[model samples]
Target: MRSAHHPATGDLSLPEVMAALSDPLRIGLLRVLADGGERGWGELRAPVAKSTLSHHLRVLRDAGVTRTRQEGTRCFVTLRRDDLESRFPGLVAAVLAAAEADGVGGGVRLASDAA
Candidate 1:
């Protein structure tokens, strides 16, 4: 297991959080991590390339929605559930519930999955 660190604690500003979610990829990653739990690089690469994935993760991390740490040579990503709750209260929960209500996990409808 990888141990990710947060430099600080608090809810991200609306703009900061929105900027992180601005990319379809980051939102998808959040869903994957939320549904699957503690995913590593290999598990996250299918939706994007390494470089692109890194960028997406960085956005999420900066916005305080996600955190990452080095586990050996691989980096693991996980949602900042506790921190988010402390900072924004219901923000993360609302997002998850909204996704479930929409019957979508990653905020997008797949071809195999209907809207």
Candidate 2:
């Protein structure tokens, strides 16, 4: 599996992070990852094509908002909560809180939620 590029936490830029979070689909993905657990690529649910989803994931990963790990043929993503918090204190929590309040990514459903 080809490795995904993940910028160091200190290299995270506020503008890039803000741009990554600007998309609702990306925000929804973050909502699922907010629990601070690794989620398989297939486990993330959104009203988008698999290719589109891949794009959003790439954006987040590139922006340093997420970390993706490859194992075999599968990829798993996790929110870089600690890294994000360290780089920009309270930013993740604040954006999540706002997204929740605004019902952002409400259409997203987690695989665990399907049970």
Q: How accurate is candidate 2 locally (lDDT)?
A: 0.92
Compared with the true structure, all predictions reach lDDT values of: 0.67, 0.92
Deviating ranges (above 4 Å) for candidate 1: 1-5, 101-115
CA lDDT of 78 in candidate 2?
96
lDDT tens per residue, model 2, 6-106: 99988999999999999999999899999998999998888999999999999999999999999898999999999999999999999999999999987
Per-residue error for 93 in candidate 2, Å, reads 0.7
Question: Alpha carbon lDDT of residue 11, candidate 1?
Answer: 44
Worst 10 residues of 2 by lDDT: 106-115
TM-score versus the correct structure, for each prediction: 0.73, 0.96
Model 1 Cα shift for residue 100 (angstroms): 3.9
Scored by TM-score, the top model is 2
Most lDDT-accurate candidate: 2
Candidate 1, residue 42: the lDDT equals 63
Per-residue lDDT of candidate 1, residues 36-74 (tens digit): 467666655434556876777778887778778786788
